[model samples]
Target: MANSTLLSRTRAERAAAERTTGEPVGQGRRIGSHLVLVLLAIYFVVPLWWLAVASTKTNAGLFGGAPLWFGSDFALGDNIATLFSYQGGIYWIWFRNSFVYAIAGGVGATVLSVLAGYGLAKYRFRGRGAFFALLLGSVMVPMTALVIPTFVLLSGMGLLNTMWAVILPSLLSPVGVYLVRVYAQDAVPEEVLDAGRVDGAGEIRLFFQVVLPLLRPAIVTVLLLTTVATWNNFFLPLAVLRDPNLLPVTVGVYNWQALSNAGAGGEQVWNLIVTGSFISVVPLVAAFLSLQKYWQGGLSLGSVR
Candidate 1:
């Protein structure tokens, strides 16, 4: 009996040892994943690094220096002055236009998405499934493919070459709606809505005062995505806008890049282009850093969760 007891103890000890041995394999996988992430981070960051380095150089220094290295002289102040001063300070106009479009569009899309998503998730109604199917179908369709049709529609309405043309299109974020719907279905409980009704609260009041607070994370996520999309959107703007004054930084930068490459529009403007590129990304980075903490909250709670 003592031998049998010892044998059982030995098996238990072997099992414990095997468990301990397996833990390092998991740790090693984590380490490998971290290493891969670091590599990818570096890979993506290199161009930004080049943009930063190049922005501080003289037009001469840009061509002369090692591509990754800083120039002999730091000319960030001069470069920025040149960037803003170029062509009667058109860059500022583009910057303002981008801010207007991105903020307005982001907010508009978020509001629409949250409302539609919540209604779809919580309410039973006719054509709900079909509408959802249509929404999902829209997501699968590429935005680029619709650019031409959008331009044609805008042209028909006589909205071409206008700020409305950009802001209006940006507000139609199908993916945002889909994200909010999925999130709301999980986050906002029907029980809560029923409870609100028990207190004689109207649906609009419940949605605004209770449901919206719960949907903050999803709302912010959609807003950030829509903002970024509007900021970076190139093709639609290019197709719709003929006025250079209406250009966003994305298109304006492309304009500079084209001139730089073709040497068609006077002396090449590489330094200004690079400098402008560096400045434009700062807002996006700031936004990501600012909004990052909310993403960690659980969506199950229905509040910013």
Candidate 2:
């Protein structure tokens, strides 16, 4: 009887696997899916390709040439030179300021989200459900909507027009907290904590030594997201900072754009703006390429583990 039951279960498993992996898809359906993917890929890639070509083109080439066509006069090197040399090399300052804000704010936010999420997930405290609901509700609130109130509060605290104004506001990422809470609930097990307790481990030690390792993928996800968000942030910085030196790349690039569009001959060094924009994109692309493997591992972790 046992052998017969085992054989039936094995057959069922085999059938399920075959249905998922061995079934033949229709040729038309496969082609349609591929075509859709190709179209989407082109949609995203075209903008970056245009940016690259535009950066290498003279201002005349930008206005006169085919929008998607490569410019014959390669001015990429000249554009970069002008970009760095403009405004007493203040671009370097903006670049540094951006890194400082993004990294510090991202790390701070990631840590806070991780701790709050882990506590909420693992502990059954008073107002736990209500607090989490509030958090989720906050996620529905747009950042732009809160900008005015945030500015007011920051001004009251004398943080306006300062780097802290930007960094402090960015640290409250409801989405990161929500994502980490979900991850922590699934990645951490009560049995493991119990085992650590039995082995004479303190709660903090267990969290730091045992649970934190398992929660790495979620941590990375939150870190990457917060960092990118902070990096690309425009409105917050624009609202918070007044000094040109404290401006991030986004605002600095925007300043160049505003000047170029101000009047005729205003577009003389427009290629610098294009080149600077392209340069701003490089760090993000490099980050994505470097961390993509971790994302795959993160997504597969629960299933494989």
Candidate 3:
């Protein structure tokens, strides 16, 4: 009886210890995951922080001062002034061009993706499987590989050096279509459409009233993706556009960098470049922040359902 009582006391002590300490393996894993996430966050944030700091510095401060920290002199306002005034304010033109391309391409791609994805998800159509297969295969193909072919095709069509060249290519987003397709399949129900149809609603009416609202999250996601893609597109714009007037900010910034690299004759516009880059990122950040709620809400709704 004394031995049995001792064994029970030992077991109780062990349980108390376990309760106090929790699971060591799970706790370690959580710590490790948090550490990794913190590192990643720093890695991504450092460059942006550097860019912001660099934008606030003069040419001399940018090079001579600390690379990641702020300079003694604040030149952000001056840099922005020079960015606008330099070379007849061409940066404004580039900025405007980027806006045009991003909006046109993003909206167009989102519309097409929504329509195609919704159709693929809801409708029974001929060659649907084959088309979807082609889409999946296209998604696997790297975008860079298509640049040359796109360039050639645009050249043949005499569309090179035009905004259309950039905007047109940005419109066909295979990933956007695929994302929308996957989202719509579950988010938009067949029964909902059928219920609307039974009420004598036209297809267009049904799409507008019943289906489109359900796919808001997917639409916003595609819009942001396509817009950002078009905004940040460097290679295609570089290859297709030769005119300085037509260049988007991405290519235009590179042009400034190339000039800076030129041995002695070319002007050094590093301050302007840094400032312009900072300005260019603002719109995209604002867009994401503004639209974040819709997608987050959708995700929460899905999770709850």
**What would the TM-scores of all predictions be?**
0.85, 0.85, 0.84
Residue ranges of candidate 2 with Cα displaced over 4 Å: 1-23, 26-29, 264-268, 296-305
Could you give the C-alpha RMSD of every candidate to the true structure, in order shown?
A: 9.9, 6.5, 11.0
Tens digits of per-residue lDDT for model 1, 100-133 = 9899888998889988998898899999999999
lDDT per residue for candidate 2 within 1-305, as digits (tens), equals: 22223423544575587667566655455877789999999999999999988988877788887878877888888777776777887877888898999998999999999999999989999999999999989988888998888999999999988889999988998888877787777568889999999999998999899989988888987888789899999998988888898999999989888877786574556777788888889898987888788765454322321
Which consecutive 10 residues in model 1 have the weakest lDDT in total?
296-305
- C-alpha lDDT score of every prediction, in listed order: 0.83, 0.83, 0.85
For candidate 2, which ten residues in a row score worst on lDDT?
1-10
Q: On lDDT, who's better, 1 or 3? A: 3
The alpha-carbon deviation from the true structure for residue 105 of candidate 2, after best TM-score superposition, in angstroms, is 1.6
Highest lDDT: give the candidate number.
Answer: 3
* 253-276: candidate 3 lDDT, tens digit per residue: 888988888844648888898999
What TM-score does structure 2 among the candidates reach?
A: 0.85
lDDT of 3: 0.85
